[model samples]
Target: MNTTRGADGKRTGRDETAEERADRMWVELIQEVRVAQTGVQILFGFLLTVVFTPAFARLAHTDRVIYIVTVVLGAAATGALIGPVSLHRLVSGRRVKPQAVSLASRLTFVGLVLLLATMTSSLLLVLRVATQADYVLLLVAVVVLWYLLCWFGWPLWVRHRHTSEQ
Candidate 1:
């Protein structure tokens, strides 16, 4: 039944030292990154094959441009998502795990944002090609909003609410 305050004089609500917390965070972050990385990698792989398809040649110039942007975003997402692994490898045994974890978390956030853009653009391109409807933009907009809410908005809200309560 003992508790301690963090350096900031705030209850951390956990019984672990900073190093222990960082280690746990690193493991959790890697697991999250793995899931996102798998999704982005698969999407990127499919995107890479799109250009070789006969249908690609028939795409309008605008669609081609969107495809290029999507591909670039996917590549960036892949890099950001994979960054933590290399980061950990290079910084291993440096006694800077807390700093490393902070950097890795930032990279993972960047990756998720990039993945959102990649997914939005990919959806737009596919719907445009398949449906050829003016409503495609509307549908994509709605989906993007959903992604924003699910990925960022809800998490931020929860953090803010709970932190304030504490």
Candidate 2:
């Protein structure tokens, strides 16, 4: 087997030579991060405003805990999502783009996971306050499953299927 190295002496791509596919994956990852950052930022900003709302004063103790957890998770998501930018900035000309991109990708994944938690808790708080349905927990569980499927399950499935076919 032959392998190529980038300027920084690091192997690039998915254990293959750095080629068009690696470039495309990098672009896709950056795009995904952009979309996620936008959503998390907006959601986090809204969560920040909730503390000042009149209704916040009337929230039950459990609801308040949920709100706090959601806010903290949102903050963590924001940090992780923005991490790529900082990573790129610091290493922009270090001739280690491949390594930086890999690290940034991990940060983005962590951010997405945090974002999922934030969204779940946020939804739970909203639904719990909006109604007294006995199936609220079930509804949340369903939505979580949906997120896991869309965010992770589908991607992993595609990766495995493609690898097997190849």
Candidate 3:
């Protein structure tokens, strides 16, 4: 559906109806959701298994804090990532998909942010455990920088540089 800047929240572009834009947005939303869902599931699985290890019991207080924080972040990410599927199933055929897609996109963004925190903290905990070397913090810092660049920085840069031309 095409949308206009009127009081009604009709679809935004051309003369496409809300249903049409909803359909298109639904497809795009599902594709993005799939990728996020997979990562969150895998990370959640790994986080759950970490508790079974004896080393987990021996973790220092600070490491334990990291573990707990990582688990919470993973849980939040999982919830946000899976929210769209449930949203879709419940609202199917209700003609609310464009709205749902927008909401889902917001949830996915939040999930990604949580995922970033989860991965960073997880790496911090792991590297600290794996290396007693003086460079452990430095190593984690490098990895964090890599993640920030690849995941967030590059995307924003590309969006800023190209989106304007569009």
Best by TM-score: 1
Candidate 1: Cα lDDT at 8: 77
**lDDT leaderboard ranking:** 1, 2, 3
Give, for candidate 3, the lowest lDDT window spanning 10 residues: 4-13
Question: In candidate 3, which residue pairs get closer than 3 Å at backbone N, Cα or C atoms, i.e. clash?
Answer: 1-16, 1-17, 1-21, 2-11, 2-16, 3-11, 3-12, 3-13
lDDT of 1 by residue, 1-166 (tens): 3344566788778777777888988999999999999999999999999999999999999999999999999999999999999999999999999899999999999999999999999999999999999899999999999999999999999988878533
Once fitted onto the true fold, the runs of candidate 1 whose alpha carbons sit more than 4 angstroms away are: 1-7, 164-166
What ranking emerges by TM-score with the best candidate at the front?
1, 2, 3
Please report, in order, the local distance difference test score of every candidate based on alpha carbons: 0.94, 0.88, 0.83
- Score residue 97 of candidate 3 by CA lDDT: 79
Q: Which of the predicted structures, 2 or 3, would earn the higher TM-score when compared with the native?
A: 2
lDDT of 3 at 54: 89
Q: Model 2 over residues 9-102: C-alpha lDDT tens digits?
A: 7664345555444555667888989999999999999999999999999999999999999999999999999998898789877767777788
In terms of lDDT, the best-performing candidate is 1
List the candidate 2 regions with Cα displacement exceeding 4 Å: 1-25, 164-166
Cα error, residue 29 of model 2, in Å, equals 2.1
